[model samples]
Target: MKIPITAFEKEPLKDHCGIVAAFSTDDYPFFETGLKGLRILQTRGYDGAGFCAITKFGKTKTYKGIGMVNEVFSDGKRKNFASFPAQQWVYQVRYGTQGIVNDANVQPVLLKHRDGDWFCVAHNGQFAKDRNKREEKLSDTVLFAQELARSREASWDERIVTLLQSKRGAWSLVIATKNGLYLARDPLGIRPLTYGHLIDKKSGELIFCVASETGALEQMGVTDFFEMLPGTIARYNDQGLHILHQDKPHQTALCVFENIYIQHGAGRAHLPRKGNRQINRSPTIDDVRRKSGKILAREAPIKKSDADIIIGVPGTGIEGGMSFARAVNIPYFQAITDIWDEPYEQRTFMSAKISDIYQKVLDHFHFDAASLKDRSVVLVDDSIVRGNITKGLVYLLKKFYNVHAVHLRILCPPIDKPCHLGVNTRSAKELIAARLSGNIEKISKALGANSLAFLSVSGLKEAMYTPKNKNGFCTGCMSGEQYPINEFGEPLAHRRKKATQIFLYDNVTNPAPILL
Candidate 1:
């Protein structure tokens, strides 16, 4: 079922659905748990949701749909599940933020991890260098998995571990191999992961559950919990779960977007790093909501003290505006629009490096601005990406109303560069802010917003899980800071430094641009 644009993107916040898995000895209602997790993630995704279970029959069963979990699974009641518990399953609600959103692209990208033995996997972050390697090429994940298959001669878990060690950037993934269950995160805690337990009464058996957030575990009556450390693998068995690895001090590359866009705002574990040196810091999901509101209240104070209506653009900024509205004692309002019916997701275009800002903004909404025709309004959104979409929104609002000024409040700071982490941002030409000559103020004016403000970098950091722990993210997009890759496997660098006049492709390559 379609929803309001702001509602579909959950207030236009760039969050994908969370993933959860539970393992036990006997088969149980694993599908039911997956369904519940997808339901929670439905608020985060729209392209679709899916889950896969490894049964005692050793058969893998998958349930997926393009609609909400309830809309898709409403016909199947939980009582119908076979009461076995020792199965491994993975659940995901995709917002089409990364990768492809086609039916074949919906993940837990099933693969025969060990000689035709099937393995199911789901990932939260992208592999920076891996994406570029497949650009303008067909099938990114297939090539990615194929490479993984070639690099190792071990169990699926070992292959995944080795694959991660060899690869770079933000990634937290889980796979269910025939041997057991495989779980691992990046060396730095950019994405959050956690686990808890649920006991079966009939069998007196205990099951271990892993998820992107603690909230998913909480929903399954597994309140007793522990956060999964980065680079750690927790293998589930009849003896409970085993931590095969622990969060370590390596090439730290946590994604700041986890706090700005992804994540469910659970706490994080911080592993601070300076250049290549790693140190411990508080790890917790940052909560940018209230702090952004407080900052907006201070920087861009509204005249008349309160508005007839407070409207958040949706998602991240909605929460901040709600926080701000409550503090100022004003009523919060949401302007509904229709944009969910668009045939494609903006993420699809971006992943291909296609730039179509207006369509994405229009697709993410199903709203009617007549509701705010003459009313006082404030628009809230997470962060500004390229000023194009926000400029289009300003045009749409002004066209429809004898409107008051649009007080635009963005939670995160200006995006100054392409993301070198999991996100797919290419070279310099694509970024609008990067192309600007003067200060950000000039850029905001060009976007046509009457007023605009951003949450501070310190404020964004503080909003995360905590000030210390094991969490840190790679914000290479905002600052051209790199994670320092070794001389090997640097394609873009190889093109610049070594292959100065050489360009190769499929062995029939050219030394320069091969015009089509």
Candidate 2:
């Protein structure tokens, strides 16, 4: 079966990694279940895939490779994973936000502590550095594993909590042990992690699942679902699920980009408010995009004489564009289609390099030029990254079809800064809007759009507000808003840097006696 593209304009954004774990009362082949879950949520990570399971005898077995989930687990390997012989399984799809993409850096970073205990850690979030500059070589996950090994804490849960408290940035983590599974998220809950369970009607066997997206859990036949509490630790095993630790939550600033562009288009962010304290309650991704579309239409109405029809850049842009067209009494058409040569490789917007993404867009996009001839088209897209996709599409339309004029509408506010969380835009210079000094008109002219309009930051905030998350959403990329925690005042990394230290499997980098 072909994996479908769900992004706007085939504009690649380096995706955040995804994690899924299943603990079953029956021997349900959790490894296979985890793999299938990863496949359903493949857009979250395309660089690498890995799975680690703790056998009944307290041994951890891990298989990792650099490629898509299917490519990493071929027919022969799938058979091997099917018989992994474990009740608990943790699978991670990596996009390498903090480290280089290689076999060693692939996740479900299995660690063998000197105390003779084995634990595997998989996470979704970008780890930030300590302002004081501590250990430098490994990514946050691996560095955490190393520090966790060195902890003098007695229990694994305590050690994990300590490590989480010490680090900064977004993290929703699942650490697997022979005894049980432990789950935790950063204080702000910037990234998403949901807890769910599948109950077998006849036997009453319960299978607990934790995943980065709700859609993955639903595909596994899960119905009892909810977001994993932020700043809390939960444990699951044969007995039942238990909350081990519940820390006070920090100010809410969950990544708004997830709702705007990253999440499964069908998924919803269902986080209940704690106690009487008000929080921002987000609508479903579809609802957010649709509402934003309506707001964009009202805020930036197009002249009927200037445009013939509205066209959505397929996938993510379709819902919002349709909403815009409906609000404005204009016809909406899916004039542009994404064409992929490989059935399974459908992510046209996952690459970090603009050149790589531009080439992919050129290879994948098919426009019905004849239909667009002499038409002033209203082109709606999710967000503008490097502005390559919009520019290329406009050029194609005008050059091939003699299009009269093209007006661009974006569903989100202008992205004026690079993302430091899990997104791929690492440098401010790489962002087209920021490069243009946040000048919308210049950006429009550069992209070849006759006129350009973007949703205002306040409008986007209004669209995403809920009774739960009433304060606001993360608009760091759009407005240069400070991030939560220690990442609040730090500068954005304009270029990729290499780590000086390495963790896992003995190396001379810091050859000291392993302690835990």
Candidate 3:
């Protein structure tokens, strides 16, 4: 049956990458310029965004989340000359809060290390906790950042040494200073970061760019390239880009989400696989949409006797409609604006009554009745999470359009499970599919569609992995690969042992690595 799309579909399945951008020479714009670079990462997340730029005065300035970049910077004007087109470095981050959401917690954290200078950082990927006394261990990340500042001699090499000394887990990082910028990923390479460069037309000078996605690099028109291998450090300075691979093994296990939903469809980042032929690394949401579309096209292309017009519900459906149209080779139209397309953008349309639902859906962008007058419309979406939005949209569509029939196509397999990683689906009350109320048809008809077609689990697995290249991904939310609560997230069984002070930062020498 059609997978009704839901808001959580866009959440990054994992903490993927961190974006660092800076103007070393007094040339490019430097006012939270990382924001400008990360604008391309909007598809990665819209919930929050933040950036920090290093200053020559050893002062670090930041403009952080709680709002859009434009909205956050709405009142502040650039007054510091230290950050851009002059003396500075920039780092930006998106996706996942790690439960540390605060202006204090927002990265890139600029602070003094043990050396006499300043260093700033932006990190991606989860840091493995002590598995016991997780909170005590959690405090260590800050202490670790503090310790790095304390132990180092305050130089470019020192910052690298300081970061290197930490036994912390996966992180894709950017550390900046007065002389240059240092970029590195964790030993495990659990996150993704890449760089390419171009010459600026305004100044006719060469520039290096680093970003979380290739789409960001492509926007700047840096076509010529080579990848910064995982576990490598890239430094930008007067001499130019200095690259060094980590002394630690550079083996990579690229986060699979980069292809599934993180990177926009520039599969050119594909890697060498199977036989030595290269494959695209990060796949785009559009790629998934296209495949879902192709699937719908194969399964149920519109027939002449079917409906007068063809319409996709919105967002997810838009692609499926195109797929169905192409598969059936018929006209595809934007039947309505997806109520959740700009899910967060609808906060202003709020009212107190359920009856007001119709008005809210209408107000937030939906249906162009002119084309939807009396045609059988096939609606496609990726998944239906809560069923509230889907139920509302169907009611709104039928009431407004004297449509022939409405068919639903879902690109994703039925979400029979809840996700534990970043998504907050531990509770069954939130998942409509998790209700296990009855048979599949009962669920589809209950949602109010003429017919429902869901991509089978195998189909979803094939569609997601084909064309793009990657091992396997964490599809725990769809197939019950895992339950929401992870035993790993649980603390080490502290009850048996006395509540000893566990320093989760720097070194674990206090207890030693000895087996108790």
What TM-score would every model get versus the actual structure? 0.72, 0.87, 0.73
Candidate 2 residue lDDT tens string, 215-328: 788777776566776677788888888788777755666787887777777676533346311212335688888988998888888767767889888767888999999988
- The TM-score that candidate 3 achieves is 0.73
C-alpha lDDT of residue 46 in model 1: 59
lDDT of 3 by residue, 199-226 (tens): 7676765666677666666666666444
Worst 10 residues of 2 by lDDT: 500-509
User: Worst 10-residue stretch by lDDT in candidate 3?
Assistant: 500-509
Best-to-worst order by lDDT is: 2, 1, 3
Residue 274 error, candidate 3, Å: 10
Q: Give per-residue CA lDDT, model 1, range 1-516, as digits (tens).
A: 344333422222334456778787776766776566555555445556677778766687776666555554555544444343437878876554345656765665676643667777776655554433445232234445656656456665567666667765455677776667777776665565667678867668677787776556767767665665566665676565666766545544566766565544443333344421121123333335666566555554555442466666655556677766665666777784444553333243343222344455655655565676776566667766655556656655654454555556666655656544444444445555567642455555666555556655544555543455223545445532333332122423322122111100111111111111
Cα RMSD of predicted structure 2: 11.1
